[model samples]
Target: MDILQYEFIRNALIAAILVSVTCGIIGTYVVIKRIVFIGGGISHAAFGGIGLGYLLGINPIIATIPFSILAALGIGTIGKKSEFGEDTAIGIVWAVGMALGVIFIALSPGYAPDLFSYLFGSILAVTSFDLIIMLILNVIIILTVILFHKEFLAISFDEEFSEVVGVPTKTMYLLLLCLVALSVVVLIRAVGVILVIALLTIPAAISRRFTHNIKNLMLLSIFIAIVLTITGLYLSYIFDLPSGATIVLILGIGFLLSSLFEYSIST
Candidate 1:
């Protein structure tokens, strides 16, 4: 309780909730559409934006937004239009993004003191500005989901049928990936680039066991994410462990328990 008195702790809690909501919403779509690989690609590619931010002396999170969106668009376009396989596109984008980050960091002329935080996450380091960014992105994500719920649902379940029925499946898919990009940027502040995909997928995966309805899934996922993240935050505070990794571990444990429960029910 006393730990809540610290501004960073308070900010971390807020960031956790915001991140949970964003990831829960977008992650549901990612899982349903089977685009986890593309999400991973966008997240790793965002590293280039982080490096560029360091080189330019700006906010890395902000830089990651456009950079991640481009990666998302590129992956979506190349996978659909080019003869290359989707896996190939993801691999190329992933490697190029990581390579660019290394190059940018090397050219920045100063040792990156906080690079590890961006790589693995440091929830305690979240600032007021980061909270605001998370809040705004949350608002955008929620609104987008609300506005296009039916279209997104249609495309996620059946792109060919959706298109035959006159839904703009391609546009909606690209937009979905872009939303995924934004979610990656928002999550980067809490879980970093490397572990971002796990955080994005795990809660939603757990929630799927309880509900097939999209709205309920998102709500349950958000609730589950909030619980796991805050629990992880408390444990980290008590033990002085890394918050991001701790949260991910907690989520992994939650998944294990859920799987066991599912198996028991099946048997």
Candidate 2:
């Protein structure tokens, strides 16, 4: 299939690049703070929007933004209050959200063909409109991360010390999560909810092995993510494989190679 022959394939390339930007920037924060599971929680919480979208007869993509944001807020806020471990709260919310989505989808009139698209990604179905939304969201996430880099750095490195310096750790934590929610919205269609946490963490995690500075890690992760995503897109196009699976496989291979390379150099 010639890439130029199909509009969907063309738009999918664009979406892949935009989502690379999203995961690249946000993934740095997630990896640096060791919030890998938190990232998973937010993506899982996105299912809440899926169910609500079905019950309300609305566009799932549109419904997902607010629903994910609310879930992120709840997770961040309640995680602070609950006596149990943070993951405990995140897990409870995560399981409940998935259950709600499952029940609602079962209750809806017809089977939603597009459900799998969001669940496991549909690179070929991406439209130019989706690309535009993705690009705009990427810009927003990037700019916000840059502007608040100091505060986020303070929070991630040492929350108690940051509080001593009056950094407003609580608000910063909430802000970081909202950014994660937005990242999930951008990524839901490109990489699927199940595997996006890999896209969000692996490249950054590998990159961190070599770089101590957050800035370098972010740059390296973005470079790795863009390369892996583009390579995956091309492979999926040529071999007729699932795009999301291809992307995850590519990232997994990249992670292994990066780890090996780092170890070899260190040894």
Candidate 3:
């Protein structure tokens, strides 16, 4: 295999780095609280955003902002106000969002090729414009997470007590949903909406088997994601494999291996 010095390989690596920041930063809470389904729902909801943008002939990522927020809000509201675990609420939101996206696509005038790209991801085509949006969103997400670190920590570890201590647990949760929305948008292009959730969850899940501190886990998740992403990109270049799938598969394998290693240690 030629040493991966190519321009496309460089672009894929850069894009994956951007993805690590967004997904790894926010995914900590999702994995801790076991809200993995929310990741899937919000990503799928992004498709509805894409369809809406297609019908309006606007930038899909820009159009996706509001829809993604609404989807997040919907997930939180349904999970909280209604009688259901987050998983069921997320499932409902997932189905509803995809339903709307398909309807909007049917209503659209012509074929917009970007939809499939959003669905399955195309790392080779991540643009400079996408990078700027990614950086801006990265700033917003990281700052918010850091500023509210204590409060989020309290909520993530113990919601009942945080509410008792007046942490406004519900509000914190809503904000978390919003953060997931932003992260999903940032990641969709690199890993695609379908596989983005796996990338978000698998690293942290694997990392947690070895660490408990949320801060350490977040750092470890970022490290694991970057490694898998770089490896996947290199493999894609050498073997001409699909980038997103390869990356996600590496993440899954990492999780399995980590779990086994931890189990062996315990035994």
Candidate 4:
């Protein structure tokens, strides 16, 4: 409770909740649709946007929004339309994005301070501005889900069938990837690009064990993410560990425990 007295701590808490909403919602789609690789591609590709932000003296997260969306669209387009496989498209975007980030950082004048935080994360250092950005993105994600609930659900569960039924499957898939891109941007400041996939997928995967229902899965995943994030945040503060890595470790442990428990019940 004493930590609540600090502004940074409060911001971290709010950001965690906001992020949990998006991760829970979007993460469900990622797990169900089996597009975790695409999510990873988008998250890592966001690093290029971060570098562009640094070079241009702009907010890195803001820059990452458009950059990540483009990455999502590109990967989706290539994998869907080109002769290349999805994995191949992911590899291409992944490598190019990281390469561009390196070049942009090199071109930027002066040292890039707090670059480690963007790469690995620093929840304790989250600013009010970051919280605001997270809030806005949360709204966008929630609204998108609400507006396209049926379309997204169809695509997640049966893209080919959805297309057969005239559901505009490609458009929906691309839009869902864009949502994932937005979720990646939301997560970068808290868990960073390196570990965003864990937050995105782990909670949703765990929730899937408990429920096959999409709405229930999202609700449960959000709850799990919030608890894990808060627990990890405090533990990191008490022990002086990297917050992002700490949170991801907790998620991994949660998944392992959930699996064991499920196995025990089945046996």
- Per-residue alpha-carbon lDDT of candidate 4 for residues 64-128, written as tens digits (9 for 90 to 100): 99999999999999999668979988998987898888899999999799889999888888889
Tens digit per residue, CA lDDT, model 2, 137-187: 888899899889999999999999999999989999999999998999899
Model 2 regions lying over 4 Å from their true place: none
For residues 1-267, what per-residue lDDT tens digits would candidate 3 score against the true structure? 355566666666778888887777788888887778887898898789888888888888777778888999999998886568777888888888888888888898988877777888878777777778888988999999989888888988999999999998999989988999999988887778899898779878888887878889999888888888878767765688777777787778878888889889999
2 or 4: which has the higher TM-score? 4
Candidate 4 backbone overlaps, count = 0
- lDDT by residue (56-140, candidate 1, tens digit) is 8889888888999999998999888668979999999998998899899999978899999999999899999999998998899
Best candidate (score: lDDT) = 1
Pick by lDDT: 3 or 4, better one: 4
Task: List pairs with backbone clashes in candidate 2.
Answer: none
**Model 4 TM-score?**
0.98
Model 2 lDDT, residue 129, Cα: 71
Q: Please report, as a residue range, the 10-residue window in candidate 1 with the lowest summed lDDT.
A: 77-86
Q: Model 4: runs farther than 4 Å from truth?
A: none
Clashes of each: 0, 0, 0, 0
Q: Model 1 misses residue 29 by how many Å?
A: 0.5
| Model 1, global lDDT | 0.92
When summed lDDT is taken over every stretch of 10 residues in candidate 2, the lowest stretch is 1-10
The lDDT values for all models are 0.92, 0.85, 0.83, 0.92
> What's the distance in Å from true for residue 210, model 3?
1.8
